[model samples]
Target chain A: MRGAVIYAPGDVRFENLDDPKIINPTDAIIRTVATCVCGSDLWPYRGAEPIGDPHPMGHEYVGVVEEVGSEVANVRPGQFVVGSFATSDNSCANCLNGWQSSCLHREFMSTCQADYVRIPNAHGTLVATDEHPDAELVPSLLAVSDVMGTGWYAAVAAEVKPGSTAVVVGDGAVGLCGVIAAKELGAERIITMSRHESRQKLAREFGATDIIAERGDAGVARVKDLTGGIGADSVLECVGTSEAMRQALHSARPGGNVGFVGVPHEVAIDGEELFFSHVGLRGGPAPVRRHLPDLIDRVLTGRINPGKVFDLTLPLDQVAEGYRAMDERRAVKALLKP
Target chain B: MRGAVIYAPGDVRFENLDDPKIINPTDAIIRTVATCVCGSDLWPYRGAEPIGDPHPMGHEYVGVVEEVGSEVANVRPGQFVVGSFATSDNSCANCLNGWQSSCLHREFMSTCQADYVRIPNAHGTLVATDEHPDAELVPSLLAVSDVMGTGWYAAVAAEVKPGSTAVVVGDGAVGLCGVIAAKELGAERIITMSRHESRQKLAREFGATDIIAERGDAGVARVKDLTGGIGADSVLECVGTSEAMRQALHSARPGGNVGFVGVPHEVAIDGEELFFSHVGLRGGPAPVRRHLPDLIDRVLTGRINPGKVFDLTLPLDQVAEGYRAMDERRAVKALLKP
Candidate 1:
């Protein structure tokens, strides 16, 4: 089997790899139909993150079930499915409470950028559609597997309400989809900050009522002006940078909510400012499992076509270019078909 | 008028001074019936906080309307009333949204800890009761002025569930009343940490189901054991110490809420822990204005007896001794008859 591997910092390769076999009773093998480059993929790709070894390179994908283990109950062979990036047994207390990402026996599928990926806890992780989706819906369904679900969680965690003003601080694919999620969740006004034309266009199309071309202060000021100086009722911090986090915090009203989905890297919360301002922070890794079912419904019903974020597509053999297009800012998102 | 003044650290004196005059058209003069020593009062008394020139002390009181300014409409002359510790016009957006402490023209009454207090925004700040209150309800009505209202806000901000376990991390008057608020809010199990006998008794009388004498980790462990290894569904942090804040955060179940009302001295939030654990934090100076009316009704109906927190009493002339007793931990809370 050929798979994408991260050999070291600033190194990525498509190499022949040994195929995976079922190791758990709830496991299943997926033949990858579509995979995509994630904004988080830039971490190790650009050497910002330390590479453990030549490792699995992708965490977002949608595929067909080629095989299922004996104990796998919900999913079956030869079915089209969407799954969360993280795998977990659905029966655990944490999973029952809608936090499958923190399930007692959670597993990460950060290497699913391969042709054939093995899924643990398959019955709980994968959601089967009524029928196989057309090639057009493939990218959108793949998004529900990770980034889309994450963005939706960000909106929900921020407690986006009907007719509320929402500020989204990142313009990556997930951030663009956060605008979509906020809109779908009934936010009356959505403001996204982005200097790039491609992302800004998609953000507007995804229901952003306004766009701020500035990065930090200007962006937050524009948001404040748009909201009549009250700031946003809900702010989503999709970028993990300290500046982005601060901008998100500063862009909210005194008693507003901040749903931060960006993976924090060297972030420090100012105790005094937070204590006095009364802004509540509620976020973490996208509880993708908790949101997958709703996202799948949106996709199936064509209520939200989030896969439009993938403006560029290529064959699995050209997965290297998928990363390059996103890294070089030529595309808002890139999808690869296996 | 005579008022309580702090000349310096460890120096409190009750003495006659010039009577307060209205500075705004919305102001009114009130004759104080009772004023109390708060847990926060000990900060300056113990010299934990710096002393400037002689400053007024005490933020909680219940009084009668002696005079009303031209624009005062809601409260009238000679009406028995209770007002929030922080006065606010109920008309502002922040106040209307239930965050009155942060109202644009809000004023604190700490400077009015004398025989007569000049309150601003009397129409929004004061709520008149049915004629004079019965004698037995004075202490309870006085509590609705500040501590009980703040504790109720803490419990609501913490999102206390109808039948879930909750942990209160401070043994002060507000913490004891948090036990009352938690129970009144329908928390089935209440665990209060207290080493002081008087506070423990008050907490139990207010419906604390269990008591943990240990301070930090041991206290958290005791709570966990009581809840069958699962942490409490809600945590009320009524102590401002970083240690108490950390304990409160650690004592909640994943996806739980922590309502912090203590004026934070120095506390830092760990972004990683908060994000990964999915815990929520929302609190500040309690939105006392938002809860005052309902609390007053609770007091009037005899559903709560918040005045039980004060075990010591004194006349206004001995305000110095009142501060000393609280600073020395000799009284959990002190009440003064003006």
Candidate 2:
């Protein structure tokens, strides 16, 4: 099997690797039908995050089961399936509480950018479609494994409601998807912060009623101006930076919510400031496993087309170029076909 | 008029002060019926907060309306009233959104320990009782102005639901009141953290089903053990220190909520740690104004008796003793009488 491996900053290589095997009775091996480079992948690729010993990368996938361990019954050989970046047992206390990302026996997937990937807790994580849908629906289904699911979580966390105003910070793939989620969730007004023209266009297409190109204080001002001098009812922070967090917080009305999905870097929030803001905050790895079934249905029913986030596509062997294009802002997201 | 003035740390003195007068059309002058020393007062008394110059202190009171400005209509002269520490124009956007503490024209009361006090935004801030209540209910009515209202806000913010588990951090008046709130909100189990035997007894009386005297990590461990290893569904943080914030955050299960009411001193939360915890956090000065009528009704109906938190009573002129007892932890709270 071939997969993308990070050796150092800006040093991703496509290399042949030993195929993954089931290591637990709860595991299953899936032959990747579609995979993608995540914005989070850039953390290590750009040297923003430390890259220790070389390792396989990727956590999003829509694949077909090649084999299943004895205990895996929910998903079996030859079934097309979608799974979350974070695998869960589906029956743990946390999972029962709808926080599957925090399942006690959770394991995050990180080798899906290969021909074959071993999925832990497969019996609980993988949700097989009734039948393989049209080939064009694959990208959206793949997105449900992570970004689309994450975007949905952000909206849910922000408590977006019908007739309410929403602000989405970050123009990344997830943010664009968040615009879609907010719209689907009935947000009357969707405001997205984006400076990139292409991303802004997509955000608008996805139902962003307004766009603020400014960052930081200016961005907050624009949001407040649109939200009647207070702020939006919900702010989805799709970028994981201190500045983005600040903008999200400042863009929410008192008693409103800020749902942050981006993996925070060195962000430190002052308790006093947050306290005074009267904003509700909830963020984490999206409990994608909990929402996978519904999101998959949404995709299949043609209610939402999250596949539009993937502006560039590549053959799995050229995953390095996929990383480069996204890193350089040449593509919002790059879909890789194995 | 007489009032308590803080000339410096540990130096609260009873002094003759000018009688408060209506300075705004919406203002009302209330004759103090009952005012109490708060745990927050201990912050400045213990030199934890700066005291710039001698200033009138206290922000809790149940009083009789002595006079009202021309524009004041909700409550008339001689009417008994319950008011919040933070006054708000109820018609403001934030107030309409159920966040009166964050109202656009909010003013915090600070001279309520005096014989008379002027209330700004009186039309929206004061909730007048139908008639003067029995003497037995006066203390409880006073509690509704701040502590009880705050505790209710904490429970409401934490989203305490029927059959859920709730944890109250801090054993002060607000925390004890929080136990009452959780119970009223239908929490099946209420765990209160308290080292003081007296407070523990009071908490148990206030519907705290469990008491964990342990602090820090040990306390969190005990909470986890009692909550099936996941922590409580909701945690009400009634103390404002960094330690209290940490305990509150750690005591809530993933996807659980922490409603913090304490005015944080100097706390900083690491964004990454909070993100991974998957806990919802919302904290602020309680929107007591929003719940005043309901809380007053509860107090009058004998559904709750938060006034029991006041273990010491003193004449209004002996306000210095009120501060001293609370500062030394000799009393859970001190009630001041005019």
Candidate 3:
């Protein structure tokens, strides 16, 4: 199978790789139908996160179960399934508490940017639909594997409620999806910080009621100015930068909540600001597995169109181009067909 | 009137001052029955926090309402009242949202160590008992003004649910009060990290199920070991240092909550630790006014005896000794009678 591998900074190559096999009885072999390049992938692609060795890429995927291990009772071959970036044994204490991402037996799923990928803890990680989704639904279903689930987690963690105002920091795919998530959660006003015209358009399409192009403290000031100087009831931090985190924290009113889902990069928070802000902060690698079933239902029923985030699509062989497009901001997200 | 004033580091003087009088329609002048030195006062007393000039001391007090402003309809003259250190109108958006400490019309009450103190927004800041309480209840009620309320906020913010395991970082009076608060909230096991024998004793009496005489990483390891290596379900951070904050965050299981109530000194938090730990952090100046009704009832009924933390008592004229005792760690807390 040909998979995308990152050998070094700016050195992504598509080459033949050994096919995946069921290594654990709880694992399932998934023949990838759709996978994508995520904003997080850019961290290593841009050499922001150290890339020590040649590593197989991609974690998001929606695929057909080509083979299932004997222990995988819930999902079987020929089933269309969506899985999160990380696999977990759903029975663990953390999983039971709805933090499947931090499950006791958790493993990151890599090499999904190939023809076939092995999924560990298949029974807990994979959420299969009643039937195969239509071809057009692949991109949207793929999103549930990570981005959409992450956005949903952000809204849920922030306690975005009906009739409340929500602020989303970041203009990427996850941030756009957060607007949709907040809207689905019944937030009356969704404010997204985005300076880009195209992203702003999509943000509005995803139910954003307002947009502030400014960044940093100025952006927080803009959010406060819009919300009667009290800040939003809930702030979703989709970017992990220190500035974005600060903006998110500052953009929430006293007693409000800030839900951040972005993977942090060299971020340091001023504890004094957090202490005096009187705002609640909760985030992490989202428990996407917990929300997969509901998000899949929303996608299948046409209730939400989060797939619109994929502005570009490529064949699996063109995975390098897909990475470039997203890295250079040419594409919000790039969907890859295998 | 005589009040305790901080003239310089290690210099506290009890001297004559002008008697407080009602200046606003919402103000009420109270003849303090009982007042106490707080752990936070040591910040200025030790010169950790700047003391530019001789400043009136004390913010915690239980007193008789000697005079009520015309607009102070709820608290009447001659009524025994318990008030938070911060006075709020209780009519602003923040007050309505249960964050009276950050109310639009908020004012910090100072000079309460004096014979007479004027309380602004008396109707909102002061919670009057059904009838004047016995002298024994004054100390407990005085605690509600700050320390006890702060501890209660920590437990509440940490979401100390029934049957949960709670770990409290810091064994000061506030942290000790957190044990009591956790017990009141039905936490099955309350673990407090403490090394001082006296503090540990007070902590156990306040309902601590276990005491880890460890600090920093070792303290977190102890908490994790107690929780089967998963960490406590809730953690209350009563210390404002970075080390205490880190211990609180690391001691909580993924998806657990940490409620911090200490006035942060100079703390910087690593964002990655917070992001990856998946711990919920919420805190600030506690909304003591919000919890006053419930806490007052608990104290009045003898259900909780938080005032036992006051190990020393002194006459108002010896306010200097009261501050000295607390500063020297000779007394956990000092209660002063006017």
Instruction: Give candidates' CA RMSD values in order.
Output: 1.8, 0.6, 1.4
lDDT per residue (tens digit) for residues A65-171 in model 2? 99999999998799999999999999999999999999999999998889999999999899999998799999999999999999999999999999999999999
Which lDDT tens digits does candidate 3 get at residues A182-240? Answer: 99999999999999999999999999999999998899899989988888999999999
Candidate 2, CAPRI quality class derived from DockQ: high
DockQ of each: 0.61, 0.94, 0.83
Say which docking band candidate 1 falls in.
medium
Off by over 4 Å in 3: none
Residue B128 displacement (Å), model 3: 1.6
Worst window of 10 by summed lDDT in candidate 2 chain A: A219-228
Q: Each candidate's fnat, in order? A: 0.51, 0.91, 0.84
lDDT of 1 by residue, A37-86 (tens): 88888877887878886787888888999999999989889999888888
Candidate 2 collision pairs? none
Q: Tell me each candidate's TM-score.
A: 0.96, 1.00, 0.98
Say which candidate scores most in lDDT.
2
Model 3 chain B weakest 10-residue run by lDDT: B262-271
Q: For model 3 chain A, where is the 10-residue window of minimal lDDT? A: A264-273
Model number with the top TM-score:
2
